[model samples]
Target: MFDVIDFLQTVGQDAQWRHADTEALAVALTEAEIDPELRVAILAGDEQGLQALLGQDPFCCLINPAKPDEEQEECDGSCEEEEENDNDKDKENDKGRG
Candidate 1:
C-alpha cells in the first residue's frame, strides 16, 4: 500500500525542507512548528493570515530554469533572441513552401 502524503513528506523532513523554496508560505508553517496536517491546511492559500506570512515576490515557477548555483551571464540573452529569429524564419519558410 502507498500513501501520497507519506511519499511527499520530504516537505516535512528537516533536511529536505531546507532545500525547498523558502519563499513559499509553507516555510512559515514549518517555522511555526505547526503539525504536518495543519501545515497542509495552510497551503490552501485562501486561508487568513496566509498571504502575510508568504514572501511578496516568492518563487512562482515550480520548474524555473534559474538556480542560485547556476550562472547564465555568458549567453547574454542571445540564445533566446536567436531562437525567436529562428522561429520567425521557420514561419516564413513554411509560408513560402505553402
Candidate 2:
C-alpha cells in the first residue's frame, strides 16, 4: 500500500497528519526519493511537469471509491473476533450439555 502521509506532505507541506486529497491528482514519480524535476514542477505549478509525471505511473492515478461496497462484506479482523466469541460460547454450551 502507498504511504498516504508521505504523499500528503509532498503536496500539503507540513500537514500534521491528514494528506489525502481526492481532487488533487498526485503522481508519485519515485518510491523513496521525490525527483528534483518533479519537486520543482509541483512547487512551480508546472502543467507540463504534472502531465509528464502522470505518464510515470498508471495504477497510482486512479481514485478508488470512498466506500467500496463490493469489498465491504470482507472482514478485516473485528468481525472475525466477534464470530470466534460466538463460536466459543456455543462450544461451552455444548460441553455443559454433553
What lDDT does the true structure give each of the candidates?
Answer: 0.58, 0.58
Error of model 2, residue 89, in angstroms: 78
Given candidate 2, what's the lDDT at residue 49? 62
Candidate 1 lowest-lDDT run of ten: 1-10
List the pairs of residues colliding in candidate 2: none
**TM-score, predicted candidate 1 vs. hidden true structure:** 0.27
Per-residue lDDT of 41 in model 2? 70
Candidates in order, TM-scores: namely 0.27, 0.27
lDDT, candidate 1, 1-98, per-residue tens? 02323433545565655555636646665665665654664565334443333323434567668888987677678899999999999999999999
User: How many backbone collisions does model 1 have?
Assistant: 0
Predicted structure 1: lDDT: 0.58
The residue-by-residue lDDT of candidate 2 on 1-98, one tens digit each, is: 13433664555664532453422343343544556566557547676765576464424456667575555455579988999999999999999999
Pull out the clashing pairs in model 1: none
Q: Which window of ten consecutive residues has the lowest lDDT sum in model 2?
A: 20-29
